[model samples]
Target: MKKIKTVDAIGHILCHDITKIIPGEFKGVAFKKGHIVKKEDIEVLLSLGKDHLYVWEKNEDMVHENDGAIFLKDLTAGENLDFSDIKEGKIDFISNKYGLLKIDVDTLLELNMIDDIMLSTLHNNFIVNKGTKVAGTRVIPLLIDKNKLTEAKNIVGNKKIVNVVEFKPKKVGIVTTGNEVFYKRIVDKFGPVIKEKVEKFGCEVIGQAICKDDTIMIKNAIEDFINQGAELICCTGGMSVDPDDVTPTAIKESGASIITYGSPILPGAMFLLAYKGDIPIMGIPGCAMYNKTTVFDVILPRVLVDEKLTKKDIAMYGHGGLCMNCDICTYPACNFAKV
Candidate 1:
């Protein structure tokens, strides 16, 4: 591209957009790139404070911002992802299905480390509905060196940086324990809460079995669900260390490997996660019965996708794990479980 005085730029093609800003009323591109400058337009150009302008120089070694954004999009997009048309040198990634949005943070950081290149995305592991905007990519300048783009592609190297994993509606089983509920001394509120939470993630509650804090009965209920082809099992109540709490013990005796029994998250410190072969069984804490969100909400998406949670994964939640419990709750959009 070449620069010229605005007064002498008649007949020359613009190399970038000319923006017009009204204090509060409007802000938009007044003149688009590639538009041929006319003799009569000089006054308007000068009024927008254009003392000088860049004109297309048709350099084969340089790539325009629009084309650069498209190149970057191709390297970052993966399954269940779509992209918007390039505008003002920017392209947005969109989710084509309701699923979990995940980003290769390591790759994203490396890409942003490059000069004149940027890729911004949502927090990793966010649940997104169809048509959600997940990320955006663009170049910092009107044009970029082709060599720089080559370096970006080499860094990406057949790996997709952004993706959405489709959620499978798994059959779920619920085991509610506590003498207060099992003996009908109090209304059983835990079963309904757990059922509602899982169903929203496309999981079906096959059945709910209430147990009287008895390890044997809880274990039997868990095995029964496994025999019934329950892909996921949730055991609510009796998770604390109280002598009467036996949900954790029952989960351990149910032939499942315990991943972690506690989380760093506040309201869900007593949470437990285990796997019986490939089926996931969780000892849901009391927090889940009342709190709007918990560690269970953080781990639920991964479990729904059949991805087993690791001890390290649960440990990472120590940072930004405390929920403010605001009067107007905005989760998944807030910092909770953002690790």
Candidate 2:
């Protein structure tokens, strides 16, 4: 950078900030560093009593901060994601629809490791709504090596790193299994909980079945819902190992393929996930009816987005599967936070 007369500084990059002071009104930088001097800025600089200004010397091998920020935006943005307008070498990722937010964690780490390059994002596997800020990127210095950006681009290849899978509202069926509930000895409390949970994800509860512990009855109830065009089926209760707990068996008998019947998460260890054709069938444990957050809470959003789960996928959830059940319930805000 070198000093140049303010009048000649037009079309030159600013090497330092231009500070402006107003009595009792404002006192801050009027033009930030790295701002390219425009023909109009000459009058403002002269009025601020600036005779000379420091400006960057152009280099072909290096890119300006704002230009580098735009590169970062292209490398990071994917479908259902938008980027903020560049500001002082910084840009942020915004969601364009409500759905699950996913990131390539390994690639993100590798990009941040590059000198003068930075990218940050919310943790992977999160439910984000439209207009939510999910990630941000910024160049660390006013100028950056162009080759470093090429390395980032090479890492990105054809696929952008961050994205959101928009939720698909499904026609749902609820199967409440328990002799007490089926016989009306105890009021049907589980159905309301499951309905509210599914409805929150925009699923329509077409119908419900109150079934006894008998396997045939439960299996028939599930098939009945499938015959009625239920896109997703949720069976509540009788998920434990007790002799009377037969929901898992009934689900198998109904010809659905079980993905993972048990999870490594507390308050949801007995949770089951299966599918018949394209429809998802879940066996929710009793704890989900009482616990503010559980494995069901973690997995349901992915299901709504049509993420086909395997045993390996369910096993990967163990790392952050323990729900803290915080009193305030700032869920989707933290790894272990849930309502």
Candidate 3:
């Protein structure tokens, strides 16, 4: 840093914040740190009795914070993501569509490890809305070493540190299975519950069927839904190992490859996932009808984006998978799972 005459400081970066105070009216930052001295700023500085200003010295190895922030923004931004203008050497990434937010945790960690550089983002693999701020990046100092920025770029490489996977509009099918519901012995609540959840992702239920605890009946319903252009099918209830529970077997018999039959989560441990050809299918547990949030909520957003889930991916939910069942639930924002 160096001190220069206010008149000559134009186009230089300010090294520290300049305050303006009015005894009765207001007192706030007149010029913030990392602000570039504009032509019009000279008069304001002169009127404030600032003849000399401390500014960042031009150096070959150093980069102004504004430039550093842009570098970080370019490295982190991905499809369906936009960035805000730099403010106080910080830039925020915003989503351009309602979808799932994905972060490259390994690459982000490497970028943050560089000295004087910082990047933070929302948790990976969660739902986000259009215009939502998902991440922020900045430099720790008013001036940072140019080499640090280069190292960050190298760490990022071709990988996007932050991105949003847009949700695809899908025709969904719901298969409400169980003799109680098919026999009308009890009201069928699972269909409505599953429909509400599907609609939240902007998907529509184009076909639905109420089936008894017979594998063949459920298999036929699955085939009928596929014929009706259903891209995703949700089979509710009949997931347990009981003799009456045959949804999982029905899904397999329907030519669908089961991804997982159960998860390491409470209230959703009996959940099942499968795919027939290109269409995804799920066997939702009974708990989903009563619980406000479950593994279904965690995985629905990902499925809407057409993400293929593997058994390993489902197994990872073992960490932070149990729901606290807070009286006042705040899902998608709470630590129900780390997916």
Q: What is the lDDT of residue 15 in candidate 1?
A: 79
User: How does candidate 1 score on lDDT?
Assistant: 0.90
By summed lDDT, which 10 consecutive residues of candidate 1 come out lowest?
Answer: 57-66
Among the numbered candidates, top lDDT falls to: 1
Displacement of residue 120 (Cα, Å) in model 1 is 0.4
Q: Which ten residues in a row have the lowest lDDT in candidate 2?
A: 330-339
Q: What are the clash counts of all predictions, listed in order?
A: 0, 0, 0
User: TM-score for model 3?
Assistant: 0.95
For residues 2-77, write the lDDT of model 3, one tens digit per residue.
Answer: 9999999988988888999889998999998888999999999898889999988888898888789998898788
Superposed on all Cα atoms, the candidates' RMSDs to the truth, in angstroms, are 4.7, 2.0, 1.6
165-200: candidate 2 lDDT, tens digit per residue: 899999999999999988889998888988899899
Clash pairs (backbone) in predicted model 2: none
- Candidate 1's C-alpha runs over 4 A off are 1-13, 16-30, 34-54
Q: Each model's TM-score, in the order given?
A: 0.87, 0.95, 0.95
Model 1 lDDT per residue over 96-117, tens place: 9999988999988888889998
